[model samples]
Target: MSDRLRVPSSVSAARTGAPFIPRVLSIAGSDPSGGAGIQADLKSISANGGFGMAALTALTAQNTQGVRDVHVPPVSFLRAQLEALAVDIQIDAVKIGMLANEDVIVEVGRWLAEVRPEVVVIDPVMVATSGDRLLDPAAEDALRRLLPLAHLVTPNLRELAVLTGREIGEEWDAALDAAEQLSLDLGTAVLVKGGHLAGAHTPDALVDAARALRQEFPGSRIDTTHTHGTGCSLSSALATRRASGEDWPTAVASARAWLRESLEAADELQVGSGSGPVHHFAGLWARGSVMTRPQAEQLASDWWEIIRPIRDGIDELPFIRALADGTLAHAPFVFYLAQDALYLREYARVLAEAARIAPTSEEQAFWAGSAQGAIAGELELHASWLTPAQGITAETFAAAQAPATTAYLDHLRATAFDGDYAVLIAALLPCFWLYSDLGERLHAGAFGEYARDPEHPYASWLATYADPAFAESTQQAIAFVAQAAASASPEMRERMLRAFTAASQHELAFFAAPLTVAL
Candidate 1:
């Protein structure tokens, strides 16, 4: 019989003869609080798509409040743990954190030499988020020696100050200077995080010894006390994603995005009194009563039913009926196309906002591509209708925005400005699902004489919506909304549903407005 491992539905299973799963090993002290050190490292690795293993270097009696005591395992025992893992399993990446003393650091460095992993990310854990010292003062030199062996070193502002022997003030430029110098001295890439700085924006940069800028990730600073293991999470995520074949810049970008999402969901968790840990699996956890992935998938049909009346209203609209029968007047159709072209420009921006705040790299890229497709595909079709006779240039589209158009665009912008990504995506779903459903329905009937006849005036436009590519995009958008809703809180899920229904109503109004206008 073949050996197949049992795993959580949320995690991938490992089969004996199947392709190897990406494995990441964390060598660090343990925190009893389960927030930082090896605990955080393993969580970060797993959440960022890696199977995590650990070699404990020490144990700390700690809580969210502070570290009380520390006990170092014997160097020989630490060596045994590393060697045992090396002999039994293949490690794709290594995250080294909190090597408490000189002997432990030396042992870890020697093991790195022997079983050299492809990706090594060192989080120089000098000071805790609670301002407690984790690394011994005398072991700084040993940690420095190990830096050259690392593919990347991550240091917060305070740690950067200690490593470079320089003062990093309130200005972000000072930290950048120190990070560049540290990278040069250690001959490695350094990630300088600007979270601790006093500002509305948190900016982090990855730079190399040659002063080459790799990636710069910027974010609006979240106001939350639950930042216990942020550095550990980012560094481990970087290692895991890098080992899984992301380039340096892409790994950093994706890791930072994961860390921000964890911060956004930290308030949902209540672990301790003092600075609690960020929720590592925040994006993956089902926040409402839905317990399984299959249950979540069922929400798609449920949501469609909930919005059925709005769908019916759109299908019954006079404007839609006229278009389906090729009886729509030229003037109203031209006016609608101009307004739609205007609508798409702002809609593209809203999608960009969605991409910026999405919880995962896959989601981010999906939204970004959706934004581009809106402009290049849908808007191009709209523009084609207004040219030659309508004299509608890009400037003309901007000026022709109607009251209904402004209302819809403003509502989306307000939701995006509120910065609740789940709600924003929910608001956007109508543009995809409703349009595709209506187009497909219109395509199936005898009434859609225009859609089937090349001689009909609006045939080309109707085909734009019924295209297979547009249908696939609609399915992807629906899947994303359902997935995000499953991972949102009960209250947040309710908010999403409300947003979806309200936007569906807007879609009905969008089509109806053209009939009332005298173009």
Candidate 2:
């Protein structure tokens, strides 16, 4: 049988053509710290596309460091909270966490039997990440009785051991064996988390023993201490996704991906001195601009810094050093110039395309003029060096086009045709930025002073790039691309950064091509 949740038509139907938002109810304890229990559940439900509701079983005075004390409310009051929502609101899914005693567990189980939410995910929160016990020893049997009421049970290593009445070993395989047995005994799916295991990887598995099915999700362990509410958040997210009609594996996969992203950004919060809370809204805050976006100039500086190694590699290339000191062999120099001529031809077309698709007239004009310069100015310089009398003709230039030259041109062409204006401009910026920077450095005697000497064999060739006008144009290109990136959406900014990095790598390859092929 398929693992997909069969969402009821009432739950799945669109209201007035609006998207159906699952009404996810959290039957868990309250955490004053707002990191775990019902607090984390509500947050995770909302973040995962659900309208959140809570029916508290207990309340805890706790912080990120540890739980100080717990208060269990009257079982009648807990029943009242569950009943009130059941009468007025249709709950699409329920996530249960941290029932402090047998009475609380029994009450929640009775409510589940009556209300019967379409999706039920129970996070057996028996022990805290700080090694504090949340569940009472006497309530363990009651919690076992409640397990069968849930469609899925999320258990950490210790919790799984308690539920299965088996001492689970430290290895992941042992955890899976226990999970399989628990799933068989309880007649429900089990989400066995490997976060507490010893290794570089944290693997989670969904096991359905009746169906003889097991799907393992492998993940790298994030080096973080701020995992205060990971189980609560993940279970709630899974409940929300299942309520939204996702299959078992897909829901687990989606929740795990979101959880990992949250963990990665957890340190940014710094909420407490000990184990901290994950940033529940990291993706939303970034994309919604709640997080500060870097300014254009700062972005340029950051991008330049990010590619320092690539820049250094270009500087160390024999081709660049030899051309700087005018000691480059005739064959390699001619080969390089011929390839540059061919590259300029396609690079000019890409620049023209960038102009055609530019959003603003100023940007359009700048790209158009740069395209003209690529064709007229750069090709003319290449022609001066790659003369037919020197045994380098149009055929010679075409035939000598190295793989690196073709690769660089292909990158530009692909970006120009397939990517957006922001991404295309970012890809184009590296050529201008790297060449001008290298040119200025060579002129200032980075390689040798021969590049500036009038009598140097390649002096005029080197001077073309070092010209103040070219440097000015490079700065202008950088400003335009950075401005475009600054106002872009988070997703667009990432694409731009990737394109810029790839282009920088291509620049290094293009510079190293001549000598690589010659050698």
Candidate 3:
């Protein structure tokens, strides 16, 4: 769990920040069954902590029983979507699930070459769990064409057999050798999924071609008919991890962990009949696990890179650092707090969602508590820091914002229609830590500058973040969320990540504060 990645504690104090959201693109077919194909890919992408965008290659009339009919889209249309996405939003990573025909695959390959994305995951889909072929006979050639361009290729046993021209065998080493051969020949990492390998538990193997890295993942073999779309889910999850800047092997490892939870819990209830779909939105309430603080530090590195430099110009007062030192100037601090409070109102909803979908009550409680704490804690910090400004009052604070309040209102209106809690939280993350980080830095080595002002508050605010207990608590929360993904079937965990991404992006947007008002 990388809770520390989002909100790290300074060991002596606790820290918080906006959030890290990964973005991904899925180029594949659509499954009307909504279990497999591009549908599953999108769902999996969201579940796995990345925002998912899709370019459809084919459309399938399918159901839990089996895929009925798949209509392949023209290569031109597929290319169009790919170009549009590449030219506009940055496509962090790409997950290619089901390219119905060779032409489609060719177009996808061409797009990849043009875009030159850093991470590409190819899930060779030939046979379904129900033993039906999805790709055309010529699809293999297309897969080979794109394989060298991929960072990783995920193929199930049947597809592995088809790709390697080997029978499904009894030896694990044989499979490893085959996967290794394919990796060597194709020049890309490969993951030979062992879900069908007749075992009490599921085992997935990842071959790291770059360093000849080999790793095995042991996951729960969930017993249920609700196991549709697992491959699409895994590929999307892998892509998300990669887009988040994880190495190829680490991305696959995390993807495998997320897949297990989704599979095991697919039958938690029923989404459809026959082979039902897995639950992809399970990471909102990661049970109370603690994560390493280093991950938080890593994420902050990016945040600081983007915004801190521009902040000093927001106001000449260095209101944040001044307030931390107990300086008497209260006007700006109160305004900042009010804007933040309004923003946190939305954050609470996400925490509520995190609490709601958790498989267990304890995890739910954690989310619930976090929601309350973030909104209230931040509010209290504002008041405490603003209390001493000469003649400053809460009413005065309310009057201070036009830029901040307008920003908050626009965010509110935009998110008003979004019912998902995870999305809301993603949107609100930036408000919490950006200012704090700014304050901490501005006061660095100059804490005594505002010493004469009792109302100015530097040490107190710094003390709050510097608390070891607070930092530990933040880390614990992060770890729990990671565990939620790690312990689940790949699909469910992936969906949760998508939700996480949506929430994170929203936070990014909050700061970007689009003129259009995305709320």
Candidate 4:
């Protein structure tokens, strides 16, 4: 996993004051089971921060088991739906899926030529997950003609074989060759999916013949049969990310990451007995109880539990364990103190900004006092550790600042300036809550007896963690953030949860920095 958290492009853009919501259109067939085709497209688009609209080319009687039958509407009605949306709304991107026949393909091609949407992602949905053919074999030529109209075409192994007129091979090299040939012939980028290959890892590549680029995205094959609409969901998410100002590679990477998470959480839905649908809003649903309307304390507890792995990882770090046992070398201990001093400098500023944007007088006063305490109290502790007798000077202290420290401060600063009060406070809470919790445990001899031993080398530092006043401050911070989240809109609450989660992860990274640099 990447150390840096990646906020979606739409959210990042909003932080920069653009606030653009991509208007995405899905021109595809309909699945009554809501697993694939236009249904999956709409869900994927919305989950990726796009406003989704749909124009149906056909309707399918299908479920996770298989496609029972398909009914194509007249080409005229499909054209009417496309024209109506085109005239009324400004489409930022278009996703084409399951064009049932030659006429529907040609109709969508014509509309594309006329409207010229900014980004077009075509998922050549020829076969269902159950190996049922959705497109007529006779329409292959027309579909090939329609390929060049799209910015990118996503094709599974079988569909690539149909497009390239070759026997489908089980080798990854053969797949790449076929993808490159299709890209060359159609003058568009090709996303070659390796789901059909017999392997432990499912790999994907974006081949652009014109640019002479072949970017590979390696992934593990999720051991699940419930990926009913992965292609439709991925293509729609790719289009939405592109429309939100991400480049082709970035958009594909983001969409693939999201799809993997959806697949991981697929079993939670249990929509069908056979192959089931991927949970479209898995990340949002997991972040907070958006559907259940949780109380403030419940939400706070959930957030803490969600970061349990991170907290556990922190406890097992060499730096943390060494410090708790009072066996840490002096240089590394001084290094940690210097980095903490650097972090508290920016952290204090973010706290002040939180106070400025706070809604109530109580919140404002709490944040403001916390900021002052961070500077006046925390920095003083750090200063005593960096004495000249320790051979640490001003220049040495400045040089001790690490990249992990900067990354944590960057997240806090970004949230302070760009995010609302609710999210900013959420981002700020992890520092108080995690440290206080760790301190209280250590003071109570959770790790060892050094924390309570006055003669211990780092007893002063450990004593600070057990401070009753600081524990009270941490509780107040948690209560304020939880109350704010409870009162927020569902969307805003989700954002808060994401901010809190990211901050907790950063805290883990921060604690690992000193030993990482020493090694």
Residue-level lDDT of model 4, residues 326-391, one tens digit each, is 889888888888888888878999999999988899999999999999988877788787764544
| TM values, all candidates | 0.54, 0.56, 0.53, 0.58
Q: Candidate 4: where are CA atoms >4 Å away?
A: 1-16, 128-133, 291-519
Q: Provide the lDDT at 394 for model 4.
A: 60
Top-TM-score candidate index = 4
* Global local distance difference test of model 4: 0.87
| Residue pairs that clash (backbone atoms under 3 angstroms), model 4 | none
TM-score of structure candidate 2: 0.56
Task: Determine the C-alpha RMSD for candidate 1 after optimal superposition of all C-alphas.
Answer: 15.0
Looking at candidate 4, the ten consecutive residues that score lowest on lDDT are: 1-10
Could you tell me how far off, in angstroms, the CA of residue 365 lies in candidate 3 after the best superposition? 33
**C-alpha-based local distance difference test score of model 1:** 0.83
Question: Could you give candidate 2's per-residue lDDT for residues 1-519 as a string of tens digits?
Answer: 123235545444753466888999999889888888899999999888889999998888889887788888999999999989999998888899889899889889888888777789999988766566666777987888888888899999988977777887577888999999999888889999999998799999999998798999999999898999999999999999888877789999999998999999999998979788888989877757566877999999999999999999999999898888788888887777777888888888999999999989999999999999988788877877666455435653555568898888888888888859999999999889999999899889978877888888887778888999999999999999999889998789999999999999999998888888854
Q: Give the distance in Å from residue 83's predicted Cα in candidate 1 to where it truly belongs.
A: 0.5
Q: Which stretches of candidate 1 lie over 4 Å from their true place?
A: 1-20, 130-133, 286-519
Candidate 1 clashing pairs? none
Candidate 3 deviant stretches above 4 angstroms: 1-19, 130-133, 285-519
lDDT accuracy of residue 209 in candidate 1: 53
Number of clashes recorded per candidate: 0, 1, 53, 0
